[model samples]
Target: MKIKSLITALAAGMVLSTTAVKAEGNAFRCAEGETYYMNVMVSGVEYWFPVYEMFKQAAHSMGCKTAYTGTPEYDVNKQIASFDQVLAKKPAGILVHPMNSDPFIEPINRAVESGVPVVTFAADSPNSKRISYVTSDNNREGAYAADVIAKALGGKGEYGILENPGQDNHDKRVAAFIARMAEKYPDIKLVARAASNQDPTKAYNAVLTMAQAHPDLGALFMPEANSALGAAQAAQELGGKIKVMNADVNGKILDMIKQGQVYGAINPNQGMQGYMGFMLLFLAAHPDLIDPMNDYKRASYNPMGLPVVDNGFAVVTKDNADDFYWDAYLKRRGTKGIEE
Candidate 1:
């Protein structure tokens, strides 16, 4: 009896120890040299800095490595070349903001086939085999902006939109904004449209022309921050009659908001986008960690594949404009914005 009790106790101890070891081994941690890269077009833009900072923080906490790589120019071909270069290094995973949607299909599919997971953020390649997309709902952003503008204009006025036509997110914002205005706020008319192409000079020229054509332009909207700089300048020139609003903010945009030169901005939750993007990429890269009761196993698909994830957004007005400054964020973080 004594021998049997001792044997039973030993067996229980062995089972418990084995289970503990397995749990500890399965805990999320990167192996040595594991690295992820974030690739984008117009890499020098301040908008990407906060996103990358959060991405890097999440990677470091998991003991993984990360890099920021992209073309300084907005050229798609150059961005693709940079992506290919990053791929050549065989990173553990990649998070990319494709300049154009369809153009990225082949590259993103190629990466997935090569066993390197790719996740897209902000702008997405929806037709690609990229594992997931992390971004705010551009349609909602535009609809919300329309409401803000219409209410500010007392539900009846003229507004013009500056566009970046070829980009997916920008196109969605413009389309949704127009549709919402026509559907719900018919009294507010869209008088003009022009492609800013994210150029301040083009935006300046476009707004000036629109204002000249429709002197009753009570508000102007753009889908991005860079164009807002010039649009706000033109609005200022028009004696601040046009309320300039946009979808993103930089230091200058925030300053303009505080000074009431720009009405407000729809700022996406960039940090959540980055942090959740890394998590999605990591899980996609390590699919063995999950075993769901789904068709993924039989279909030979990534069980972790997510079609889209909305990180949400915030409205930045003069009251909260101080909280959205990138310089202050970088200073608090004690790190170079995107230099490293």
Candidate 2:
């Protein structure tokens, strides 16, 4: 709330932190003709495109260049090959968002050991020694989603969660949502938990099957974007028999929200993550001024605080959807704030 107010008046070339964006300061200023290159990594979903576009624009503004690459789907082998390609090019720095937390540890470690000043964004590789992570407080986000659903159901409805059970990020988010609901709302009953494998068709079938089998099911909570999209289709076909709450934003989901066909989404400030990732990498390569790992946090962060930066999320509903009008960077990427 406070942060939104601040952003309303931000001038060009300002870097928005949770607290403030300086008057004359910018995110970073690169040296003339400095070949600062970064690879923006992601495990592709509908959600990753906007983020990469944001990073690319930010790099351009700072007089640097960037390459965007990732596995188009959630394939470990494909992701590894992509990571290797980025490393082989030996960019000034690297920013990777791993598909799974543990499997990518070795590759991330190699990136760091080779002095690549890597930072994880969105989905993180926590076990690996990535410099910093930029993402929403996923647990907090889950709790928030649960709160919304519980209130909507009047605290006493039977519900189910369509989960991507093995992914650490999704697992933690779902767990947080569940724990918060149990702690705060006593009578809400959880009927079932289904793994949707982050597939839209699978989620649609699962939701259709569940709705048919359990006529009493009042709501469905989905934590992955594809599943959420599938659940949207199911909700549409079910003729409003079920209520849904889920994470991430997409063109399809935004339209569903506008039509009151699906519930709101918890959306990460992904553009900011890409913007910050570029800033961190640029700073790491150009400066002996601050130690990328130690000194930077001490200088510009809340010390008695959260370790990772919470870029925060804008809870998008029809009422507030207009607040997130497409920026120039988003338009350049061919996304008109959830337009199909």
Candidate 3:
């Protein structure tokens, strides 16, 4: 596969519409006298703030109100409770990142069954009756990490993984990385797999333990950027031997990549995920405006369409780390071509 772009319009903090949305045209009509509310619900609150920001940007562009509500802790129960609380308001639609697949089915279905559309983002509850799912190709992200790390190590080295085991998307990334390594780079052995649960401190301790046990460990791959805080610190303290690789990018992670403390990152187009997720929810909720055959009642697919949006990803390294920073994205967003 060819190298992905350094930063796409969506990754640059510019709200992008997947397909042309008739936000105000005669083809689309808002619910009369009803204040349409859109919200994003997630578990790892801090890590997803940028995504919520972009979600707000999308809501702003569409002339609607949006809110962010979720648990800071990585607790599924807390997220579920938060979901319930958000549902009580009877918002127009919801965009949620379900922590696990099985636990979210009932709540998502309940929301949909009640006429409030829900779109899952980043992480999905695939079997749930969600109108749509929006995210990057996580399996390919893992495969990308495996390719980069293997090439960095000259195709042979012992590597460890800092995994968020139970989460569906993170698990897919870890499994794909391991499988890609085993299938394509047989000599690059996976020495240790530690459960970090998306916490940096836990990842730090896990890396320290793995380094102590493996000694020959050449690299470490984590599923998300937050864990890089600890993993990068551990690698830095370990005389800079164990290279750190992971998915997602942010201000701090990009700095680590520039300083060579972290190897590289696979950056998903989070802005697209947020913006398009809201779009999906809006479109799903307003099926009255969308119809292949000219009416939601007669259309075979409008509200119940199970569309999965691939927002795409990019591999970030020191060479283009500057492109993925939050500040740079802000500047780019101010530019004419990419502004929301």
Candidate 4:
């Protein structure tokens, strides 16, 4: 009886030990001091705050660390320099929003070659060796904005666009807006196109000039929030004759929407962009975590090669503007907005 009892106790102990080993092996938490980073140009912009908040949240959930780094300026060269500085830290991975696509190819490729994974959000370097791209569908957002503006104008008025010429995503938005207007609403004329370059003063002057040149201009569209501020001010000056719509929203944009100064906005799902971007970077950095039966292993490619991820978007109108307020969101979150 004593021998049988001893054997049973030893078997139970072995089973428990095996279970513990398996648990440890399967755990997804990060190693001590392992960190990931979110990098962008125009780092001080309000648009990036919500994004990094979610990225930080996702990292913390996985017992990992996260940091936000980038240049406050819009210059692509400065952005690349900041990216290189982050790379010098040898972080576990990075999530970057390249200001322009082509200029980032070499730097991104170099990072990937050095075994540091990179995932881009909001913009892309398609020719680079980055593991993944995460963003809303810019074409769809532009087309949708066109439809909204056209419908508001009753389909037979002139409209103009404020552009940021060099950025890939911004260019796509402008192109698709024009194309959609041409394809679906031939009666609506595109009378003016001006390069705002994301400058409020430029957008203000452009909108004012376009409205003057084309007295029948019923609507205006821009690809970003800053330009919208100036555009909306111009529209208000014109006694709100022109409806202003833009791609992204800030607190001021939401206020304008609420006050009927701006028509509406197509807002990207920034939280999802950050969360999924970090996940992609983490997976790319730790390719050994997954071993699905695929050709990636044989081809000497990273198993986590996700080419594009559409994080999705939302249309913000007066009805839902309150729900999108960044200040309200931060207050609910109980954290400093972007300071941490």
**Which structure among the candidates has the greatest lDDT?**
1
Model 2 regions lying over 4 Å from their true place: 1-44, 291-307, 322-329, 332-340
TM-score for each predicted model, relative to the true structure: 0.93, 0.80, 0.84, 0.93
Clash pairs (backbone) in predicted model 4: none
Ranking by lDDT: 1, 4, 3, 2
Q: Tell me the number of clashing residue pairs for each predicted model.
A: 0, 0, 0, 0
Q: Report the error of model 2 at residue 225, Å.
A: 1.9
Query: What is the number of residue pairs that collide in model 2?
Result: 0
Report the C-alpha lDDT of model 1 over 28-136, residue by residue, as the tens digit. Answer: 8898999999999998888899999999989889999999999999999999999999999999999999999988999999999999999999999998999999999
lDDT of 2: 0.73
Q: Which of 3 and 4 is the better model by lDDT?
A: 4
Q: Mind giving the per-residue lDDT tens digits that candidate 4 earns over 165-278? A: 878889998999999999999999999989999999999999989988999899999999999999999999998899999999999999999999999999999999999998
Alpha carbon lDDT of each predicted model = 0.93, 0.73, 0.80, 0.92
Estimate, for each residue in 18-65, the C-alpha lDDT of model 3 and write its tens digit. Answer: 233433463343354323333333433334655665776766665676
Q: What is the lDDT of residue 100 in candidate 1?
A: 95
Output the better candidate (1/2) by TM-score: 1
Backbone clashes in model 1: 0
